[model samples]
Target: LRRQDLKAARESIQAVLKVAPDFGYAQQLAGAIEYEAGALAQAVTHLTRAQQLMPESLAARQLLAQALLRAGDPAKALATLQPVLDGKAVTPALLNLAAQAWQQQGELAKAEALFKRAAALDPADSRTRVALALNQIARGDASALESLQATAADDKGTVADLALVNERMRRREFDAALQAIAALEKKTPGQALAPLLRARVQMALKQPDKARQSLEQAAQAEPANLQAATALAEFDVRDKQFDAARKRFDALLKADPKNVGALLAVARVRQAAGAPAAEVRTLLEEALRANPTEPRPRLALVEHHLAQKDTPAALTAAQEAVAAIPDNPTLLAELARVQAVAGDFNQSISSLGQVAAQRPDSVQAQLMLAEVQMAAKNFDAAVTALQRARALAPRDFTVAQRLAAAQVAAGRPEQALATARALQKEKETAVPGLVLEGDVEAAQRRGREALAAYRAALAKVPASTAVAVKVHGALLAQEPAAAPAFATKWMSEHPQDAGFLFHLSEVAGARGDHAQAEARLQEALKLRPDDPVMLNNLAYMQVLLKRPGAVATAEKANQLRPQHPYFMDTLAVALGAEKQFDRAIELQKKVVALDPKNPLWKLTLARLYLDAGQRAQARTELSALAALG
Candidate 1:
């Protein structure tokens, strides 16, 4: 069974059990076979019977405990191991099993102690050392690499070699990892482990084609290897073969019904394919039911709710996940993300602070805190957190970019410009730095310098739509008469870009050429027929032109994004244009309710009431807007 001949092993065990039904050893063997076959419940039944028949059999008890843990019942596993733990038998195997149970229960300190004890008792046990090394790695100890290297050198087996590959990857030593994986393949020819490790290393090196080929080879070499199959399914997802990924995950689930990875993978694929929300929800809920203690499905549920824009539901799911794994920094970080998205910025900051406090050296945690602070417009706090992150990851470009942006937001444009220029000098491609320079110069009203910066960026990356938009906007702001000719030339070059057409419409509007504005918006609409923003803009232009069907076009935009305040405001304007005064007033009221602090919604509401011939309501709304001022 350990050699993967499960059918033959099961048949032999069954034959022995049939001849001697009460034989404890045969029953234990049968139970082990079932466990290896992924029938956890049946394994538990047989193991329990074997324990009852031979109450003093330590091996039977150990197997039962392992089966319980695999069944996602850590509490039951601890209970099954109680006798061995209390009797002080002190076997390295028993300590290792107990350590796993404690780890599953989130008792990391106890687990670490037990793992150390086991490693001390069996000094040459590679598996025990590997487990201890993993714990150390989780705590950010670089010495874990030494332990992992020692284990790999001693064992030359799958677990230790995989650990070495992962450690190398974590350290960003992709070339070294690849070399190690190649040697592993030579040592274990035709084995799936080496190919899978090679695929991961190739992925880290950004060699997608090589990674895909290695994944396929691994899957072919071991048809029953779930890790290989999962990797292939994930690769299919990346390739946009959603149906193929779903099929693979479905097969995995059918073979092992309680496979959490398969469940999550299928849900992810469905979500990516834009499957119905209810269908994705059902899949995630089923996974939660199957493995209630697993944090992955719960976190997925939180993300799903957030994507659907159900903030309260997302918060509730995040809370549940945090409750399940209270000490996990990753889960706590996820809770912070949900809180931030739900507009609970203070609470989000508090949660993130906890994670940073727990893992002071974690760059990811510090970066997350900085991001939330920036979103909250607490620029000074963001700067402080980002400086910490920059100290930790000095060469990380993203950290540098965000720090520069935060410095600009904090009213230190000179410092931001210096940082951006330094980044431009450091990198071979300096388009992003040039863009940042343009943004800073534009903020400082240095129009000519900003234009020069933008042009430089466009020269480097001519096809960059964002750079084109920035250049066009800067030209229009500085030299309005010259803007039209620049827009015309750019539009002629990028005729298929609806976004550029929209920018042209804005430029036309600023120049008070309503006809040209309407024409450009119409052209954009033709290219992006189903885009709600395009629909809203076209409808608004039609309303301004007093053209017919404006209401219908705005209604389509509203239907596409029912909760969007801007779309609703456009629909209200269209209603007023069509002389549906009462409907328009009601829609404005809803918009005001959505964003009460917006003086624009209040002013719009007042105008709608006056047009509806409701003097009292108009006076009240105008008074409110005046109070806001």
Candidate 2:
């Protein structure tokens, strides 16, 4: 075991355990072997047995606690260590482990106090000191910088130096971080971590060429490092080297064909490169086939179908996932979501109700139930569910916020305003509550009141792009003539804010100046290239101008955000302008289906059909449009 021959050690320990199954020492050795082998569950089982066999064995108990923590059962880990922790004589290691459990449980103050106690108990233990310093930094303590510096000075180790490097990077002291990373590299020759850190800092500094070189150095220093390779591939994607990124991910898949993560990564890269939807779906399906019970691939598949507006396909995928992972709450929740999207509200409600009944104390279960109930337009039911969740978690901001929204939707705006006022009493929730008040006012058609509330929200958070956008939208809805001036002033103050620029482009379009609108949207696109809404608008403007690239632009927008009725209509317009009548008609039909009540979409469908020379279909759509009018 000391030589790191964990495989041989595991074999030897298993053989001994076969003969002395009840021996505490053998069980303890087995647990150690399994832990060193990185088989955390097996290690926990063996260590638990060892503790049961030798109740007074401190080493056995400590090992069990360590195994439990590593297995991500931090509550059980704390319970396992409680006896030793309560004793008058507790080691620094035990205190550190308990502190980690508290940290994982989100009790930051308790974790900081435990870490301080551990550090005080053993001032010479550099590991505990480093942990304490890192915890202090995470908790945003003003003394963290001093603690980190002291730990780095006293420990003279790479771990503390690395923590200091991260803190420097967070402060945007890139040059200092690079120097520290270089010093660490000199101290530990042939280490991959220093180069990786250097590459990250270089990227943050916008030195892409230098970052690539550093990443290559990291990969060369550690040929087996999957993280370095993935990082390099992500950089290639950022640089628009799509083929290069695909090749790197393909190499990873070749090494481990059944790797679900690699498959998912490849699928994402393909999507970014505008690969065909079929190809992306196939990759996700392969990942699901590789790991039938893995939720990620299943969820991805469902989302993919949903993006295409293929609700039936999404429902099928969700059903298959639940079949594979029977009785799993997460998959069941996903199933209910797909059902709700497919308009099977009764089934969705029944499924979520079963889950909420089973996990009566789970706030998340109640929240999910509330979400589906809200989606189904059962606002009162949603309020009840959210109220139940609020009862379970009175301090939960999300639950309270959702409850207010549900109250407004249920026509109880007075109750919602009262709830919003209560939220405003809390400093952390003040801005959100103000926004909710604006939404409630807007829902009641009190446009002036809504604008006032939104302006108040923006006043409180002047730098918040989101609140600013809300204020701009409310201005356009309440007073259109004032929108352009407000947007112009906002752009002057925040030139790089893409959302405001997009809204400015909308105002220009509303004024019938398509050229100016297109130019503004193009500027916004430069800021956020993959913004589907901007792409759709630009494509529509291009179509109106009879531009040559509208078809490609519209297609790219559809690829980025598939299945939206409006985006689909824009693509159809662009396609018809380019004389791709067949595809245009096909897409327009789907758009009409999604928005059947919209006479404009029906008119567009009639035009596409006529363009495709399908006179019967055109007449049918025109008749439908006439009926709508």
Candidate 3:
């Protein structure tokens, strides 16, 4: 077994078990083999039998406890170890196992105490010290770095070095982590682990190309390295190379038929590529079946249902996951998110409150609570939650941005502007802050100030589609003549930008140049032929220009966005231009029905009826429009 001849060891263990079915040592050996083979549930069953057969054997009890923990039943692991613990016969191994079980159960204080006890019992043991350092790191103690570094230095090429790298990652000390990885690579040249660690650190540092190269190097160096291959596949998915990722994951599945990570990765890639939801769900379900104790597949299933807008299914999945891991903050947070999306705001808040109580320092939980409150239109409550989150993570730009947005939603534009200005002072390129400032200025009816703010943002982030659109819209609203030159200059610089071309078209239409508007719209459509808004605009301009096939273009736009009233209205106008008054009236009436309160739709409907010579319907619609005044 120590030599990793798993097949021979399993056969020998079975023979021993067959000869002495009641022998505790044979049963324990069988259980250990199953555990090493990743058959955690079978390991638990065999180890339980061994423990029951030899209730006084501490080794059997320890093995059973370890198997139970691996099977995701940490409570059962603690129960299994209670006799030894209660009898005061605790070894360092037993203490470590108990600490791990407690940690899995979310009893961090008890876990840390047990870890400290284990380290004190064996002060020279690097593994126990590494465990204690990991516990301190989890609690955000920077002092853990000293201990972790010492362990890594003393225990080269061991798991301690991996823990040191992980601790550095948790602290976001990417450069230091990379240095340690470099040292480890130098120490153990040609090994895949160092390259794999480098890839992970590179990814965390947002150097995706470097990370990809590193992952490729690791996979090439060790063709059997499942971790490196899986990371490479995930990177492909992130890069939207779905076909390549799927092929690689399929090869992995062929190598290990029940590879749950490969199944989950393939499902995620398929989901991102907009594959059929049922197909993605089947893959996730298969992964779940392969590893019932794993939470990732279950989480993916919930996310899949949520993405499909099957909120009820999502809620059910989330509830089941929370039930399975009641103390897990991540699963609880997922349940809260599902509840919020399902419109059960009260339940979502209750769940979030529980998570906040359990994990008081979790900014994610507080942020989720804020999101739920914002969705409920309780903007003031959202502000409070966001304030808490900001207090917890004061340096997080996202929390600050969300807080400003929430303040704006709560009708505190001045406060929002103040926050945005403060953020702008802190950031070197404050495009988001400038955008928010523009929004607040626009909301206050300061058109000139809003335009200036938007222009400033555009200057900082010239390639930002959103900022460019805001700048163009603000310019058009405040200074129509300047809008054309601004848009034309931007278009010259960004010839292939369909949005800039669309903006130019809008400017042309505003200046009553139907020919120029139609030309610009056609150019924009060439760049983004499937954009329904561009098609609708082009169709509308074609009708105004009295062009041939205007009706066909309008119909195509309407087909692309069947539920859009504006698209329907454009189609009606094209039909009316072609002397199809009855069909035009029908389409106009559908538009009016969609937005009964819109005076524009009512007026259009009245004109359509008048054109159709329906005096009674036309008079009724005219009276309704008059009443709207």
Candidate 4:
């Protein structure tokens, strides 16, 4: 041994092999130690001995593979990981290693797919997701979200782990979750997730001291577990013991100098203390070099880019991450949202659909998919998604809201009201539902009953936005001036909130006070520049007034976000006014792309094509439209 540490190293590694005979790292290190001591034949003997003890050992196989590779046998190296890959319950980590080997073997597509499969197998595996997303982008799938969401949703194991953890935390069942985690600890004794998860559960259950104690133990067990160590450090930081946290990380780095989690966490702590972006980026780069598949540092980079309005750069980062981790639902879903905002509905829908398919129980994905469908006028699909969401979470208010809208659009407003009423009855103990009952009454034209319902709601519930909005909107028909004054008084008492402002704007708009309406709209736009309905209304008003640049503004609104189908009809008008007949037809194509079930956009496109002298294309489009209808 050049370092003359052979006896000590042999003893340490021998002890590991005794318990974990097939341990790849140990056998590979032992073989390498022998090789470095000018003992190639001896190295082969040690590796051969390891192969006998652990035929499934990647370390032994890898050492032999490399031994063969060095002796001009690349083919053998390529075949070395078969046993590991063929093992049951092949975790994403092992899959990642196998994929790297595949890449080395020049099987690009197989490599990419395996990376994606790995990502799908482990949704929380940030590294695998980033790698898959990056590879997907390389394949010219600029819509990286499509693959990312698909992978994330297609997990092979329990997909409800996060929700389970959250639910258990809510119930203060930290001990139960920890009991499950003990199995994880036994399998990966020094893995950071075991104790960090236990600590998080403890913290959520309001046992701060216990949480701190668990983190301390985790740090002791796994010095490279930055999650646990950093969490403890943050508490120390709050206690003005930043030096303690720093010293802990420093000592950890001495052991695992390339520990990405510790480096990234340490850099983040520095950044929060007003360190330079250059410093943060440097640390992020170092972490990424240590683990290229990780998405966390890249996500931080995306945030910084977004803050600077460098959307294209942010999109690029998202695209790279999605490529590497096709199964990462969050990255994929967010990428879809970014694309949607960038005027790519078809891409967005594809991504949203993938997310829904993979995670049928994801209320967020369901709601988002439904909303996207509503924009495209796929009312049936929207309703279907909302129904699924209702099934998953019967008590979620957001699901109720979407279901109500879908019902209205699907020519089932009566059913919508019924559904809302049923939900309301279930919540009669709460003031909000009683008030919502008033809305149902108003929808049925039972104004007097609606007023009674409102009063009932007010009796129990404090004066709030929902109540005021309902009260003013319902009361205005019978008592105009009095209603306006009351509405204004309530609005004055609660300024700067969007829901109230929307109501006040609607009131002004209904009164034919265009100036006042425009002013309110401007204020609302300041709060939400991307409000599609407001944008459409403002564009329509501008168009009617023959205002300059109305066409450009209308087009911008259409391109930027989902609008009511009414806006598409309005956009058709805007396009015709601007004499962009051909472009108008393509915009109509977009409408159809948003909702293939809707025939309106198809008819519009067919007519526009005929007017533009594309008779053959027009005929084909007309035939499709007829078939669609």
* lDDT agreement with native, every candidate: 0.79, 0.79, 0.78, 0.63
What TM-score, over all chains together, does every model reach?
Answer: 0.52, 0.68, 0.52, 0.43
Give the candidate order by descending TM-score: 2, 3, 1, 4
Ranking by lDDT: 2, 1, 3, 4
Q: Poorest 10 consecutive residues of model 1 by lDDT? A: 157-166
Residue 263 C-alpha lDDT in model 2: 74
Q: Residue-wise lDDT of candidate 2 within 421-471, one digit each (tens)?
A: 777888878888888888888888898998998999899999788888788
lDDT of 4 by residue, 158-191 (tens): 2122222322343356675665455445544544
lDDT for each residue of candidate 3 in 1-629, tens digit (9 for 90 to 100): 89878889999999888889899888898999987775655566678779888999899999888766544355667867866873667777787788767754436567666666766676678767777887787778888889888877877544456555655655678898897777677776655657876887787677989988998887676443455666777767656677987776555566455555567767867865556667888989899888676677888899878755678999999999888778877788899999988789999999999999987888988899999999999999999999999899765768878898899899998898887777677565377778878877887788999999999988888787778889888987898688768776777888899877887788789889989999988998899987888888888888888998888998888666664679889889889888899899888877775555567877888877777788899899889777766
| Model 3 pairs in collision | none
Compose the digit string of candidate 1's lDDT tens values, residues 417-470. Answer: 886687688565388888878888888899989999999999998987889999
Best by TM-score: 2
Off by over 4 Å in 3: 1-258, 266-279, 427-431, 455-470, 488-629
Candidate 4, number of clashes? 17
